[model samples]
Target: KEILLLLVADMKAEYIPPREDVIMQNESPDELYIIVSGEVEMLESEMENEQTVWTFKSGDMIGEVGAFCCRPQSYTYRTKTLSQLLKIRTSNLIEAMKTRQEDNIIMIKNFLQHHKKLKGLRLGDLLHGVGGDYGDPNMYVNLLTVASTGNAT
Candidate 1:
């Protein structure tokens, strides 16, 4: 279905200078980014401290989970060197996906798999309590309420 062409139709290329922060921890993802060049560092932030937990290079993608699931990303990403990135706004991608049901389903599956890999990365103790569960502690309650109330609520 040429998902790349569908996504690229409304894509924006970003040129980020060294040390620029591209994504921040706990912020809801609005866009998905594919690294085109240079380097990006993913940082784990807690309290007032932040540390680099991973480094992303050309061809790596970020914000897939947040863009697909409308959740917050657990790590913050910043450019470590001059970087070129291809960005796709969530709204645009969703709009295109709606036109092709099969492709949309496959894309969502891929995003979920990508999220799983992020969690499985070997970090051990540093990852004891890190990752996607950073959503609202009350979100589950709201979801249950919606389920009981009705999907139209």
Candidate 2:
């Protein structure tokens, strides 16, 4: 919370009503949002189907990956309820990180730890994201098998 406060102290805050899109799929947003209140749902739209990939609430950082990697948002985020958010442009976020190297590393470590603990799976499941993003379920399963047993070919 302190870290987020520091990051957002100089940024503008926005209020979004329920069901409004925060991050649109296929549109690259150069900013990351720190949710101050309310819920946001992350959705992935493929063809005519839109799937709920995740839901984030107060204190959660949305669009971190895009902000960190400078890539287009792969999912769309919409408010599930009335929301209050602090927006930090990617350039500013990067600059802040650069100025606070130790804190930034800790933040990155926390994110990695969160990913490791995600969905209650072991190390094997970590690689599932790689395949899932590429639309290859078989590859995920295969990679899980390999990762779990420490087998390589």
Best by lDDT: 1
Q: In order, what lDDT does every prediction score? A: 0.71, 0.69
- Give a tens-digit lDDT track for model 1, residues 47-124: 899888778889888776566546667678899999999999988888888887667666655544554476546322
Q: Least accurate stretch of 10 residues (summed lDDT) in model 2? A: 121-130
Model 1: lowest-lDDT 10 consecutive positions: 122-131
Clashes of each: 0, 0
- Angstrom error at residue 32, model 2: 0.6
TM-score versus the correct structure, for each prediction: 0.71, 0.70
Cα lDDT of model 2 by residue, 1-153, tens digit = 555666767688999999999988756658888899999998878888987877887887777655654446767899999999988887877777667656776666665565555465332332223344456444544543454344587
